[model samples]
Target: MGLLRLGAAGVVLGLASMPTFGQRASAVQLPTYSYFTVGTSVSVPDRGGAWLDGVDRAGSGVQSFGSARLLGGTRAFGTGRSAAGVGITATIHDFEALEAGLVDRRVRSTNAAPAGNDAWTARLDEARVSRAGRGVPSVAAINAELGLAEQAADQEAAGWLQRGRQAEEAGKPNVAKIYYGMAARRATGSQRREILARIAGLQPSPEAGQDAKTSETRR
Candidate 1:
């Protein structure tokens, strides 16, 4: 299983607080009811292409990203312990070779982005579930519950750009600077350069300068 079993709240409390295996129990495990985690992994073979709850081929993986399955796909699969034993098979086609007409690499090698958004969010949800004492869902199951939609980085930058423009029009240079700065972080190429130029055009507020001077005088 990709996720390790967690406590009722999906948290791993300090083991030092508990007695050793042979010792008597003194401390008790507490549940916080919240689960969260952050990490990444790259499974070289990813042999048994994941099922909903680690089963087998979930019917067919509909290409979620690229043109073909290797590029990425989404599919429905069975869940629960019944299907647990499925998809455990591993072979040559699973790794180290290209399939017939398919141009992409095999199962694991096709991991285009190491810690993609989907995987990361799934891990987070799994962590919560495990901590909540609810059984952890398989990677496939997590995908089944999630949607493919997401705001692209450029789209987010555009929103920030619009906010900055609004602030500028309202005569709030300080506020506009904050929004423009955020826009620059997600903007690319010319858009980023333009944001920086806007930043340069705005002058620091007179009140800000006086505040700095007052602090210096106090020192």
Candidate 2:
């Protein structure tokens, strides 16, 4: 669900042609595959009370980033009335709030980075399982399968961080931030500190003393 928030910005860049709904007929003569992906982020705030000094807060807030995708293929059989397909899904999660706590010299949050991948196969027994029999294969079942794939992908923190680095180098800081946030969920010790530093560096800083410059120039 978090990954689904990526919206139009989540488009997969330079992807190869994959099978579309109308291509099933032609797919019988060849292999057919397709893919879908999502990426997004969310914020989590701490409800704990603040310290006496407002400068140092008692609670730490977190920013979570997530990315997920599904790659699937279908094989038609017996005049294309029935088909079997397999899908692999992967997900990544990075928690920036945890990193913030580390940098603040306070262990206020306990969250981890997660990444994972999984695979599932489905068979279409008939062109139409039923006209009103709750649809073919069941939506709930499909969702369950995809959920498993997401879990697997979410367990691979290092992989997601590497992807974040790649995105950053490719001039996609927004995408890189998402990956880094997910990687931060699993980072520890010095590695965690390093990720926090990277996240901080990605943020834009305001121009220094712009108001004073304008005032002096006007005078």
Q: Which model scores highest in lDDT?
A: 1
Every model's TM-score: 0.28, 0.24
Q: Note the clash tally of each candidate.
A: 7, 18
Give the root-mean-square deviation of each candidate in angstroms.
36.6, 37.2
| lDDT tens digits, residue span 57-152, model 1 | 223222122223231323333222222231223322422123523555443344333465688776765565444667678998777554332246
RMSD (Cα, Å) of model 2: 37.2
lDDT string for model 2 (1-219, tens) is 667666434564313323332234432244434332222222222222211111111222332222223343333433323333222233433345557557666422212222233222112223233255665778899899987766655566668779979977876665677778777766665766787788778742222123112221110
Model 2 alpha-carbon drift over 4 Å, by segment: 1-155, 203-219
Please provide the root mean square deviation of candidate 1 (C-alpha atoms, Å): 36.6
lDDT of each: 0.52, 0.47
